[model samples]
Target: MARMPSAERRRQLTEAAIRAMTRDGVPRTTTRSIAAEAGVSLSVFHYCFDSKQELLESVMTTITEHYVAVVRDAIRPRATVRETIRAGLQAYWDHVAAHPGEHMLTYELTQYALRQPGFGHLARRQYELYAEIYEALIEQLAAGMELDPSVKVPVLARYLAAMTDGLTLNFLVAGDAGAAADILDVIADHVADLFRADT
Candidate 1:
């Protein structure tokens, strides 16, 4: 068999690890299981990644990047800040509704990252990525609507990050999409009010 390039093999191992972790639970997943999932030898797994921890970090990155695309693509720019906020948030909720497993896996990995030694940084960086995505979305909305500079982009980004996290957890636990979405709609209005320069 022909040998796979480093990058391609790395991607394969990362994706295989994600599946193995998702199927077996992160704590129970083993390098052997991951190698089986990848159809690669144990040596290949070790060659592609230094350790299981490294492979898991890659899995976290992969999942994060996946949802970033989902959330970004769902949001539609609109005429007014209220419309924009509502559109973006509703689209976000819709994505969560459609991909509950993906969202659940992300939160699970976050908890795992938080508990592991030398891996807590992954959890922190996950939120940082969330904040960055939110900041970019806020800037995009600002192009069409005037934002209150005093409120600050980072502040609002963190606020949205927290709100979405809580709402997603709530929905996952209660399966109450209707209530969560309604509350999110209200939050969208309030957030728009806070940032709206016109009002």
Candidate 2:
């Protein structure tokens, strides 16, 4: 048994749980450990998150929300689609580079979701949303150019996304942020080329 915690305290605990998850990973981030790390009682942890899965879901939502908000905020009304996408990519690169542990945790969740159909649905939903955003960026970037009807817009989006994800994976493994930038520049050039291609 533990003392009741304030709402602010609960928020703090949740944030601490996120930090712990980032640092220790999914298997290691138990409620007791989080409570201890947060300087709160076990009851506080229970009161805030019904279960470890709930806590992880909240953490995932929080991270994704932050990523989406940052990209949205960086959007400029006068900027062209490529410019907006460049800004978004830079933001994502920076965010991922800064939070490798959290990213590894995300990958772990994705792997776990592979075995759980319901969770896989959640993953697919998120994937669709992200894909749609990137597809819109691609469409806007190539607004004046005609594309090969055979090359679906969704396929382009997936390719662009794969390029970014590949760079991210390289950075994660090699720990080279500069290499990630160079890779993005290369990807951007390729995207431009695609946009310039004749129908």
Give a tens-digit lDDT track for model 1, residues 123-161.
888889889989998887776467776788899999999
Worst 10 residues of 1 by lDDT: 70-79
TM-score of each: 0.86, 0.70
Total clashing residue pairs per candidate?
0, 0
* Candidate 2 residue spans exceeding 4 A from truth: 1-13, 77-80, 115-129, 132-157, 192-199
